[model samples]
Target chain A: MKFLVFLEHHGDALEKGGLGALGKAAALGEAVGVVLGEGASALAPGAGAFGASKVFASEDPALAPPLPQPRVDALAALVVQESPDAVLFGASVLSADVAAGLAARLEAGLNWDLTDLEVRDGELVGKRPALGDTVMVDVGWTDAPRLALVRSGALDPVESGGGAEVESFEFETSDFSTLATLVEQTQEESTGPSIEDADVIVAGGRGLGAPDKFTLLEELANALGGAVAATRAVVDAGWYPYATQVGQTGKTVSPKLYIAAGISGAIQHKVGMQGSGTIVAINKDPNAPIFDFCDLGVVGDLHEIVPKLTELVRAQRGS
Target chain B: MKIAVCVKQVPDATVHKKIDPATKRLDRFGEAALNPTDLNAVEEALRIKEAAGGEVVLVSLGPEKAVESLRKALAMGADRAVLVADEGAAGSDLLGTSRALAGALERVEADLVLFGQASSDGDGAVLWAAVADRLRRPLISQAASLEVGDGTITGKRQTEHGYDVISAPLPAVVAVSDAINEPRYPSLKGIMGAKTKPQETISLGDVGVDAGAAGEAGAKTTVLELGPPPSRGDSVKIEDDGSAAQKILDYVVERRLL
Candidate 1:
């Protein structure tokens, strides 16, 4: 089986999720990497270590700003040429657009929210979560060049210690494709590591009491040298930024150690952080479902418990 | 100007959700409500209609019950609604839904189309782009703000990096994010007025989509298995004694996590 994986990158470095897709695809079969952006061609060699046998790069000034239209045009052109059995993508804002556009352009089927992939009887199958992730459904594509969009942070990138050949493609985009212009791009300023990259994460839920109480989580996360995340309840309540939300509807994370404070451990929140190596729940409600799945359960008030925990961790660090 | 908004009926997440052991599908038993984010799309469309002097129409493709969601949109002040109810659409994936919805939009002759960034259930966030692609129209997704004018539709899309201000022509597709605007609740007068509003039902065939190309037969992907995720393993419960924090710290230290 042959697969094509889209490598999302900013400048010369590729996103870790894309590398994960490449790694998965390479494990299944021959995996080719497709990179589209301003300096897309320069990213081919790095794609090799991630298991890409060959890299297809499309570098056009018009494709700058990483908008989806030009990317659709570019990927559509490449897919028509390569005709791989399946196309896979790692989740991101731009990847979502390009994947949808490609599926529409090719008149092919796109299956999304997938967490795993496998080849069965010479056909590709994807695994996705349904019913608030209470069930994991096996999904398969009905057509060739089947498209699959994996959820972000679902796969881990592995190095094969191999090299890949790089190929550059030049294509013409339709005038209509270039209609949308990206005015500007700003990065949200963050203090510590992002949830996606943080090895340790401290997440809070409505149990945090108020937005101001989030400081307790912040202090605890800081003392542990980890990032802070929030449940959908707090994010929906505007107690925290949407970026820090961890749930079925928010970002999926798999930190080595996840500390959920004041979270009820709803299924929605559980699905997002279930992949953590060790889960610690601190909630006053002993009946919170989070305790059922957590590695450690602490029945207590977060406001009282979190500060004490932070002080202890700080003291231990100083020791 | 004419605008069409796509809406979906999803099981409210606040309630208990179940999956059928036999079929391995989300049991459609229980309260079904309009997708919350789609309410933002309806509100955004209504605002555009109020500003641009146009009609807002609602389109949905699902079981007959999905019309309940369309009716809710009508109650929110959409001029009309179209329901594409067919058994053939039962197991359709995002692509099939897009094809069916795009066909319905073509019949409505929509100048602009809108959808929520993603449904709370599927959370795919890729449907509108597929629809826009099928219709050969430009797409602006995850819009935080939107405006329609002089044969062009512009929107601001939120990204992890920041935001992107994007503009497309009048015949474009836009997906609004929850950040776009606060969705308005249906007022008493609007709910009563919605009772008399026009609602039409169309089939997949009526919209030029073949039944064989949708639902289970036409689904690009099929579900092979359904089961709960793995357990998180044995948990070490900690009682809230005065020394609970010290115990946690000790555990953290033992794990070398600090």
Candidate 2:
């Protein structure tokens, strides 16, 4: 069976999530990776190491634009021409955008937020959390080019692998139609670390007592060279910026060490962070759901516990 | 420059919404709301217009009552609004919705366009791409933060392994992440102004989108079934006390839950 993987790009190579997603598509069949930008070949070894047989570069001037239509058309057109058994797109925000458009264009079944995937007995099966982690759904599709947007951070990039050989396949665009016009593009400067990609996240909530308490977390984040994440409550109270929220409606994180202070682990929030390698929860509520999912549970005031822990970690570095 | 923001009214996240056992799908009446994420799009568009100086038009495709969402957008300081209403559009799958949006976009000369990264309900980010494809423009998705320059737009995109800093050309369709900005409420003057604002409430018919291709009938992948996620088996309440820990340990060993 042949499969197509869509790659999202940052510059000349793959966007982290798109690269990871192409890694995912490699699991389905003899992989045919499709790229839309220049220097995409630099990103091919990762896909190849994951099992892609070849790469198809669209080489469109507009491929690198962080826009949806051009990316969608490039992938959709390639999928249509390739007639692969299934297609995979990164679950990142941009990948989600392309998957939605491609899924619609291909009229293929779509399963979102997939965490694990495989090709079993000629069917593509994906596992995703459902009902707040109470249930796990295993969805499968037999149709050709069955489209899926695998969740960002769901699968780890293969750690021990060499770049795969690159043999260019054809990227065709004859059947594609461009509907939207590009008027202008602008990119914003980042202030804090992107929440979804932070390694060590220090998240605060209403339990922080008052807005001022976030100061310590900020200091800790600065010391650790990390980002400060917030609960919806903090943002609602105007104590923190909404951009720093970490939850279902917010950013989902898979950091190595996630420290939740003063925040009651709402189920939605838990779903977003439960995947962290080691979760440390500090809430006065001993029965908080967050504790149930944590590697270490500290039943105490965050204002008191966090400062001490922050000092401990920082002092460990002797900085 | 005129910009269009594709918006949606969704169940508020905080609201307790449960799908009815009978229909096994979204219970809209469960808790009505304007999708919080879309508000980011509305806010971003208004901010752009405020900064760069342009008109912002909000568009939505849903039930007639969805005019409330458009009105809310107006209250949020949108310069204009459009509601593509038709029962036929109710169940429009992603493609149908995209086709509908594409038809409307063709008629509207928007210099820039935006959408919520994904609607909280459908949680699908299609409109930006479909519209972009139909319009033949570059599309940027998941714009966590956006800055517009004299001739280019740049921002960081969340990716699988890390964030990507990307640049795109003008007239791009962007899906704004909720992190972009908080939405503003309609000011007293803005409320009064919205009343005077020219909002052309067009139906699906006006857009020339084939009703057959706009909703359930037009949808490609139909939901044959919708149900709650499979439930986890009963949990053995593991007592954590040192004495009870033995039982928990025994249970863990017996089950190999580790």
Candidate 3:
């Protein structure tokens, strides 16, 4: 099967999720990579290590901005030229828009938030979690050039030794596609690793008591060399930035250790972090559903326990 | 400035949602409510109408029961509502659903279209782009803050790294994030008035959609099987005393996580 994976990149660094999708596609069958933006061609060779057999690079000025419409036009043009059997993407804010627009533009079938993809009887099937991750549903496309958006961090990128053939492609952007202009872009000031990349995640919930209480999680996360996350309730309550939200609507993360403090272990929050290697729940409510799934459940007041835990971790690290 | 707000009826957040093994579909017979984020879309549209001096109309596609959810939005100060309810459109996927909704928007000739970033159920968060593509209009998604200007709309959306501010002309599609605004509760007076507001129901044909091109027949994807999620193994529970912190640290050390 010939699969085309959309490799999302910022400058020369390809997003890890896209690389993971590329690696999986390459493992399944012939995988080609499509890169768009100002220096897309420069990033093509790098995809080779991630299992891309060939790369199509587009350096159209219109596609330079991180907007979805222009990238959709470019991908649609490439789809017509290549006509690959399927197109894959690692779900992200920008990639989701591009995939959806491309699906609409090409009138192709699109499956989203998929956790896995496999071949069955020579047909591609997508595995998706539904109903708050209570069940896994097998999904299949009814047409060719099937489009899919894999959940972020669902697949891991593996470096396979090889070089890929890089080819430059040309595409046209419709006038309406360029109508939206980017006025400003700013990065949030943060330290340590992002939740997606952290090995340990210290997540706070309404149990944190207040917005400022998140600093306790920060201290714990810092002691453990981890990142801080928040439950949807706290984020929606404006106790934390939306970027740190961990739930159905926010980003899914799988870390080595997930420390949920004051979290009730709701189904929504569980779906996002259930994949963690070890889950530790610290809440005053012994009956919090999170304890049912957590590897280690602690019934206590987090405000006191978190600070004490941070001290122990720091002492253990001898820092 | 006529605005069209697309909304959905989802299983209540507290509900333990399940899929019927026979039909492989979400059993929607339980209690349901308007998707929480969609309320944000309705609220945003109402705000725009209050400022721009035009009507805010809600549009939805679902079983006939969905009108109850629409009424809730109507009670929030929307002028009217249109629901596309037909057996033929029962299992419509993103494409088919967008086609039907786009047709309704076309009929409305809305100056702006709004949607929640995604439904809590499907959570694909891409339907707005599809509708916008079908309408051949620009789309600005994940809008945390939106401003309707003379002929353009400026939306600020939070991104992974930070946020981006984007501008698109009128007659655009926008999907607002939950961070945008607080949805207002329907007052008793508004709830009573909503019953008199026009609530129209149409079919796939009325929206110029071929019946064969909607619902399950029009869906481009299908479910092959269903199973429970992988289980996490045995867990150990402990009551926190003075030593709870030390026990956790020991567990971490035992696993060599440190």
Candidate 4:
């Protein structure tokens, strides 16, 4: 089967989720990738190493700043021209729009909230989480060019060291499609890597005693070259920004190493970070629900334990 | 500007959900309430109405029970409410739901349409875009803040790194994020006044949408199987003496991660 994956970028580099989608598509069958925006041409080659055999790029100036309508037009044009059996997307604020618009434009089927995709008996099946992530359901489309939107961080990216044949695609948009204009993009100023790109995450919860005490998690994260995250409880308490919140209602993260300090592992929070490779939870309450799922659980006062841990990591890193 | 806010009646998130074994779908017969995020959309619409001096209309699609959500929106100061309820509208996916809503929205004259980013129950977060596509209007989603002036709508959309400032022409679809504003509680006087507000209940035929083109029959995706999530198994607990942190470091080191 032929598959086309939409690649998302920050106008500088391709995003991990899009690369992950490409990786999955490559595993299934023949895969192609498409990049859109002003700097899209530069990102085409990167997908080749990850799994795509052919990369299509549309670099109109109007496609800059990551707006969706122009991208929908660009992608719809590609779909009509290429007519791939399936189109895959990684969940993001922008790609979701493009995927939805493309689905409506083509009158095609879009199965979203998917965690995995596979082909069985010559039919494509998508797996999705339902009933608040408590269960997994198998979903299939009634027709093709099947559209699937995978959850963020659902797939791990693997590089194949293969080169891609680059091609350029063009799209014509109406005045209504170009009505939305992106004025400026301002990133939140932070010292370390953002949570999405971080391999290691040190997250805090209400057990931290107070908001200012987040410095403890930050110190350890800085020493370990990781990022800091927080539970919805602390974020809702005005202790942290919603961007760093990890839970059902917040952003889902699947880091290489995740350490939960002073967090009680509620199901809402667990659903978000359960995909982490290694989970180490520190809480004074031994019976905390988080202990049921974590790989290693430490029972103690986070205030004393976290500071000591930070010092040790700092000494080990010699920073 | 005349505004239309899309509200949905969803099972309360606080309630434990049950799945129908046969259909593999969530059982909505339990206690249902207005989606919390839609309350924010309603609040945004009311604010836009207060600022631009226009009427706020609420639209919903579901079973007859969905009217409860519309009434709550009316109580919150929406000038009017429209309920599109049909027996065949059950099990409609995001696309079908958007189609039904677009049909209802066409009946009213709206300069702007607003929706919550996502419903707590579905969490798909793509309905507004579909509605916009069906209506062939501009869409701006995940708006953290919004402004209107000179026949245009502008908003700041939150992103992983930061936020993007985007502007679109009027008569666009806007989905507000939870951070936009705090929803207001309906006053007693407002609740009483809402009872007198104009409300109309229409069926799929009334909106010119065929029953076969929506709800379960028109669903683009079908569920093949439903099962509990994979278990993580049991975990190991460690008593934190003074060396607890060292053990963690050793664990990380053992895995060659550090």
Query: Cα deviation of A245 in candidate 3 (Å)?
Result: 1.2
Interface DockQ of candidate 2: 0.14
Could you tell me every candidate's TM-score relative to the true structure?
0.92, 0.73, 0.95, 0.95
Best by lDDT: 3
Q: Name the lDDT of candidate 4.
A: 0.86
Cα lDDT tens digits for candidate 4, B1-258: 899999888887788887788777778887889988899999999998898899999998978877766788899999998999998888887667888999999887699999986787865878888888888898899998999988999999987777889999888999998778889999999988888899889998887789888888878878888877766666678998888989888888887767
Clashing pairs for predicted structure model 4, backbone only: none
CA RMSD (A), model 1: 2.6
Q: Sum up the clashes in candidate 2.
A: 34
| Candidate 4: residue A90 lDDT (0-100) | 87
Per-residue lDDT tens digits for candidate 3, residues B111-155, read 999998678886588899888888989989999999988899999
Per-residue lDDT of B1-258 in model 1, one digit per residue for the tens?
A: 898999988887676777676765667767888888899999999999899889999998877877776778899899999999998888787777888999999999999899985777664888887888788788888888887769998888776555678888779989888877888989899998897898888899999999887887776766677767765567788779877788787777787777
User: Per-residue CA lDDT of candidate 3, range A1-319, in tens?
Assistant: 8899999986458988899899989988999999998779888899999999999998888887789999888889888888888999998889999898888888898999898899999999999988767788999999888999998777888999899999988887887899998988877878987787688999999998899999999999999999999998998888887788887778788788999999998877887888788999999998899998899999999999999999999999995
Fnat, model by model in order, equals: 0.74, 0.14, 0.81, 0.71
List of chain A TM-scores, every candidate: 0.89, 0.82, 0.92, 0.92
Model 2 agreement with the true structure over B128-212: per-residue lDDT tens digits: 7656665666566666788887866666555333445566666777777766777788888877666777677687788888767
> Model 3 clash pairs?
none
Which prediction has the highest DockQ against the true structure?
3
Report lDDT per candidate. Answer: 0.84, 0.66, 0.89, 0.86
